[model samples]
Target: MLCANSAGRCEFDGCNKYIFYDNITAKKLNASNVAHIVAASPDGPRGDKTRSYLLSDKLENLMLLCPQHHKMIDDYVEDYPEELLLEMKKKHEDSIREMCDLIFVPKSERVIFFSPIKNVSLTHIDNQLTAQALLPQKRPASTCGINISIESAFDYNTSEYWSDIDNQLKRDFDRKIGNELDSDPNTIFSVFPLAPIPLIIKLGYLFMDKTNVDIYQKKRVPDTWKWIETRKTNSFSVNRIVVRAGSNIALIISLTAEINPKRVTDIVDADIIYIISAERIGVDAISSIDDLSDFWHVYQTVCDEIKNKECAVETSVFPAIPVSAAFEIGRRYMPGIYPKLHIYDDYNGFCKTLTIGGDC
Candidate 1:
């Protein structure tokens, strides 16, 4: 209840302040009626005595505000920040002086802590988290981090074994390329169709991704190989083969150019043959596909095992047979050996084969 005396004296502990009745107007005046310190709707039409207080004397809800002070609280409460209110409440607890500082000559003011509502950027944070989690998984384990040993096997032809390995690499490369090309028909074949050549040569690194390699290699190939262009002059040519992979072994060949190297190279001038095979080494961080570091380290290991001989560069590219001669022979005598390729070449670009054909 509001503090008022029998003679309408303000009974609040504050110094005497008396409310008087207007004798002429016959209206009794005193701080008796409960006043809402803050109005929920302050902007409503002012001075309309019909404006009602929301609650009275639940001390927890009501305040002992004079009429003028009541209006002031109402006006400011609309834009008040919850944090500022909570801070004011914390400073006012159990201390009249602090309460008076928060209010004007007050008894007590209630306290309330307003929690903040935050709007987070979910997409941005999620993307950052995803990158952090996935990057480590994608990284290849370093050789130092993992332990693996390699041993040499006595085989009839180390070159043949190497060739088989090269064939496996090529098949894998083609499969990967095929999967990528299924989406776009206009995309040309992979540039390194020669397969394991690129891996052994360290040139395959240029074709890191299938899409990029296809574009580059396609541009490099000439139609002359598929369609031989013979002028008035006869030219000597060479079929340069490149084998590549992450492994240390490689096979490359530069054969006499009668097969019309115009599509790839004009002359098989320099037969650059380098083979770096390994017998007992470690394989670490070597991708199953065209991997040069693996090839290099393995080559070194193989050379060391062979007492560091010059020919120990182990992997060598050799011309198994002349391309034209093979085609003619297969076509004439062993028609069964060669498939009757349609003149309308349906070559769907380079693809990985399941098996590396020995005869081809």
Candidate 2:
């Protein structure tokens, strides 16, 4: 019972090594030792006169451990006390049981997308990191990644480059994502997006909500794409700067990182320029789905204003945001109600703009 509960592993606090084989040699052997939490004799390590007599031969006092850990625990009785051993055994067994329960749970499919960012030569999303992020809570459907990235001419900052990428994304998404949904309409996807901010948005737009999708953002401090719980999520602020009142609206999104208004004003001329920034702006500003929903609340407010006034013919967007937020922006955008999006990317310095909602 003890061995089965411990999953045939060492029940030591820090060591859960399987004891079914020799550690050094490539040979199958049972290296398990059944140790007594309360020793059989009163003089033994952590021995008690009553417990040694009562629990010595009982299942409650037995622990499945590796040879090394079993010897160490018995030799160093003071360090590995009866209380500690009992706790460790319980924890190991409970964890193993939990894992067994998860075997029947359905797993989420991994979807990866990558692109070349200017000045940043390295753009790789390690599969292990993505897998680790989806742990005890969510399991991966398969080790194979549904890769949607296409080869390019390494030609950024050109019309041909943008044009080629735009078509490639649509084609691959149709082939990879569309075909999958056709076979099984109820598939769940966990999305890991690492691409140019504008392209990430476009990818989100193409993806839509055909299936249940989970968005992942690569964090800065804990340098991974896993979501962490912060003391507080992001709160946004909207600063309206109306240069002249006509029909043109310019939006500056500074959530993942802050941006200077002059950067947007210098190139694109607009009547009313909106600066929507997070109260605490940085890479880790957003922590959960609620945070992203909060951003949409603010964005929707701006949209409501635009729709109410009914003057703005088009909206120019200059964004310095996270991949998740950028993706959300594209996904949430209304092509019929909202005006066309003139997107200015970080790279290319205002050259070769990407157009969304106006792709007719």
Candidate 3:
């Protein structure tokens, strides 16, 4: 039962080594062992008092662990104490249950064609696909040159101009795309980026953290669209803590360069804090997909910390990161397990909140 509860994998934190393997010849090899949270022997490590009298042979006192972890815990009882082992067992069991539930739920699929520019056309796409357009109210009849007539179609060359349009588009997306996601949490959204590159980045920022989505970019020659996947990045370290005052929220920051220290100091009162600084990798911008993957690893670690806590989560990014990396971050957040995400946006040199999911 313990192995089944752990989904046939190791229960150690962040160690998902599979215990049961079947080869092509149909021979099964098992490398898992049931480790007792409370030592079975009276003279064994962590075997004293209550454990000696009770819970020694009980199923509730056992945890499924890989061979290495089982040996390590037995060798170093001080590090893998009874309390910590019990907590890890509970968390791993809970995660398995959640995964089973998600596997059985039904999912609906939809394709969204978002074109905020004039020159791009979606007419060649299949008519059977559900198409939602975001065209301007009016456009010049002439087809000789590219003409943009959108309400917020401002110049993207200037930072101020792009920021204003980005904000406006954010509001628009919250109303339109956000509504669709709210209707069905299991909806598979396939998005095609046909707007300005900056707007595409803003579009990624607007996607509610944790929602399932796929991004695609168009290729010229034969005009084919390919799915873009976020690759795993190199590992990064984090500094995390849990506070007990103010808003019951977890703050996760990934700094590629540097952010305003004042902004971080302002939120020290949060229930939990997780900071992943750029100093770990010594890069201002995320140079590879591996960096983004590394960022995601830390993000998930922070998520694990606050999973059982009754609090919202706020993720803040410092300096500036690549749009692709931002998109990957938004994609990784699993809305069902994680609480509502409050993303911070800087407006007029002041931090503003952008709520994703949860009563927004």
The whole-model C-alpha lDDT of candidate 2 against the native structure comes to: 0.81
Residue 77 displacement (Å), model 3: 93
Model 1 has an lDDT value of 0.27
- Tens digit of lDDT per residue, candidate 2, span 264-304? 77787777888899988877667777788888789888876
What are the TM-scores, per candidate, against the unseen true structure? 0.18, 0.72, 0.38
Candidate No. with top TM-score = 2
Number of the top-ranking candidate, with lDDT as the measure: 2
Lowest lDDT 10-residue stretch of candidate 1: 108-117
What tens digits encode model 3's per-residue C-alpha lDDT throughout 231-337?
53345666765555555554545554445445655743455466666544333334444656676677677666665543555443332343444465555556567
- RMSD (Cα, Å) for all candidates, in order, is 29.0, 7.1, 23.6
Regions of candidate 1 where Cα sits further than 4 Å from its true position: 1-160, 190-360
The predicted structure with the larger TM-score, 2 or 3, is 2
Supply candidate 3's per-residue lDDT for 195. Answer: 53
Error of 2 at 350 (Å): 2.5
Q: lDDT, candidate 1, residue 278?
A: 24
